[model samples]
Target: MTNAGPDGRRIEEALTGGNMEPVVRIDDTVRRVAGPWTPAVHALLDTLVRGGVPEVPSPIGIDDQGREILTYLPGTVLDDVPPETRWSDSILQQTGGLLRRMHDASTSLIGGGRHVRTWRSASHEPVEVVCHNDFAPYNLLVTADRLSGVIDFDFASPGPRIRDLAYLAYRMAPFAEDALDDSGFTAGEREARLERLIAAYGVPFESSEVLRVGADRLLELADFTDARAVETGRTDLPEHAAMYRRDAVLLVGLSSPQH
Candidate 1:
């Protein structure tokens, strides 16, 4: 495939975790196909940067091709790393802390009409903060065992703080079935890591609450994925939905009192 853009700049690489939009890197900038939600996400990023939250990408103007441009963060995204590396204790703790910083920074947007702005993802009630709805390892940038940056705000929307935390716990704590790929830990490790993550966030939350919320989040995501598959004609997404459902069941079981 040709790696040159219409402007003749050499495309450095095609980024992953862009399930809906095409993303590419050029020089010190990354470009992604923009949607109606682009403006809101850019505004959120700008607000976070102005507020001294240093871990997210800086939004540049849109390109001639109608793509949103962002200053490239120089670190390896967790998706490109080995499974064991993605499951490290330091990574889990760092991600939890970074998420706390992001949520805290994003709370500033709640009162500014930013909470009701257009987003690709649906907003939930009690909008305490802007949730990076997909806070999984795939969207995290790591350097020297630290979560140095976060990317891909396409799914962000206004929601409760624990909404983001729950999704993060589901993916990082990984309450998925063992048959799936990248199911990094044994069932016994889920609660421990979940507790560790919540502790790092420095919040008072029950692990069971997180698990229950995580299950609900997964069901919502499954429906979203199924709809996207139908809209985009991506044959593989139904399987992705199935996996989400399976994981949701696991989380529900884990959250139950008998367990």
Candidate 2:
């Protein structure tokens, strides 16, 4: 691909890879190609545009080559943290509110949206809106410990609210020894932070019903990951599946007050 833009300055700064397409950061824009998940992503962007989601970037339309262009959101994504920074209650609370807002806006688009897999369970009913399936810290932009924006909606789809929440908790919780490697904190500390986050989101943290449903949804995610890995012939994904199982065990164990 050519590196020069209309102004003759170097446009490509970085490239984020995916199974479907490549995400290139150029000057002040992000260009994404039509990947396997393109239809789902386009559906999500359409919903966000119609709903007027404030923090998400507005899609500028597709190029002649069918690549999507979006305004670049400024801020650092919290994929990795420096040792000095701590995961505090306030940050967790903000994240909860952000998630709630996104879920609320997504209701209208729930069943109409498209994506990789359908997230359905007996407890959590499906809703219609764009779901950012990978709404983890890595995809979120933060400034001064506050959520500024989000990116990389490659896995966005229509699904249940709890499905998204379960994924978020799975990624955010420090249930294993290696969990703190990225967050720079201990498992206990991260659990406490996650508890505060759940409470802040107005989710019933103490309800047996909620816990049961969340656990089931989490297991569903594990099954999905394992199945996808096997189908795609990814040899390395079984390790992830094993880690998730271990993590699930630790999560259940820690949920008991006696633990």
Candidate 3:
């Protein structure tokens, strides 16, 4: 049996470009095998779109093969971004502002009765919004000096707004030990970066709180990765999980630094 897209054209070419999900790009759309929660995710995406949220991908209909389709967005996803380009304080500030806009838009979704179950865990607090959950530089599409869009809502779930911000701060401001070597941010610079991001997001969070949440988030990610590795029988996944576990150490090291 062959898989077909919404237009009945054969789904052509697996998009190896993605880090997760076996996505195939057919014509102008990207299709992936629908998970059980995809329908709920589609609902979330629809709400975000109907709410006029920016930086989110356009969700198309499902296909006969039970694949979810989304409009293919264009821009750069920087995994190997230059140190100079990746660590710009102004760019980080702008990116944080975008996140604030997203969080604000998502605030309307609270208690609206739309939720999906995924591997990503939510924090224990009053629900602020459904979060991107995996917001990071690699998931973001950047054009020139500004972030064009945010992608990969697969892990969207309900959580405290700051928990979402914590994950973002972990990756963007990178509240970890090797922030200096890995991201060209000095100890004091990283503190400033965390403060700048929180301030840009226009939220009242102690820079210290972001760090605490970020550390806890890493521990959760480590466990999630470990369980996935066991279930999928992927040995490499554990090593990857260990990397995040190692970051826990780095995170602890940062506790002494005055933010």
Candidate 4:
């Protein structure tokens, strides 16, 4: 199930790092099917690199096969870290700090012709920076007990910083219903972790605001997933949509003043 290159190196190994797309590793490079928005993603990567953000891949031009090319970051991609280490403060803090770096680096791109840029995700108002619309642990690369790199820019777009942070908090802070609460933290501990992550990111908003936004984010995700399920006839998406709605409702209560 692999191919060899002209130099006798393994040319193509199907990568299982992401769920939405088929990705392959070609020696030191990664390739995936590109879309019209790819050039803008490449531009954003270039800007991030120039802005001194570490641990992000450098985008190469498209290949003759019309696949987007990028440097392969070698590390264990933490799709779902094991329960033993899942709630570790180290990873949470590291993820928060890394997100801050990406957001800060991406600020330079805001209002610099980003309105015309083609992104897979629609731009949100009050665009302070280019948001990595999917910033959860699944997109993180870990090495030697630390964060090494981040991947998947297909959803990058101009949006409020909280839009991205809310999703991260949903996964890491784990604003989930009982069925989805796999982070091994109690309610109080989960709240504490949420605060830690927000503090690490150095954002000015209260965590209540973040939880409210997180609820809205989940509702949007549910609607999108439902539509995609109908279009693709993907059986799993309906369940995903249901889970998002349940979590969104939970987050609303958590964000309420009475809570």
Per-residue lDDT tens digits of candidate 1, residues 43-84? 899988987878898999998888899998888888677666
Q: Which candidate is the best by lDDT?
A: 4
* Colliding residue pairs in candidate 2: 109-128, 109-129, 110-127, 110-128, 110-129, 111-128
lDDT against the true structure, per candidate, is 0.84, 0.63, 0.74, 0.86
Tell me the spans in candidate 1 whose CA falls farther than 4 Å from its real position: 1-9, 112-116, 178-184
Q: lDDT winner between 2 and 3, please give it.
A: 3
Instruction: Show the lowest summed lDDT stretch of 10 residues, model 3.
Output: 115-124
lDDT per residue (tens digit) for residues 9-31 in model 3: 77687654324667777777878
C-alpha TM-scores of all predictions? 0.91, 0.74, 0.85, 0.93
lDDT of 2 by residue, 1-259 (tens): 5478799876766654222346777667788765555555655666665776666776776766678888778877655544233255565677777777777766765543353433322224455445676666667777766777777776666666666665566556534334567567665676666676677667665523334445665566678779978788888767766776776666676566676
Candidate 3 Cα outliers beyond 4 Å, as residue runs: 1-13, 16-19, 112-124, 176-182, 256-259
Cα-based lDDT at residue 204, candidate 4: 73
Choose the strongest candidate by TM-score: 4
**Cα deviation of 116, candidate 2, in Å:** 15
User: Model 1: number of clashes?
Assistant: 0
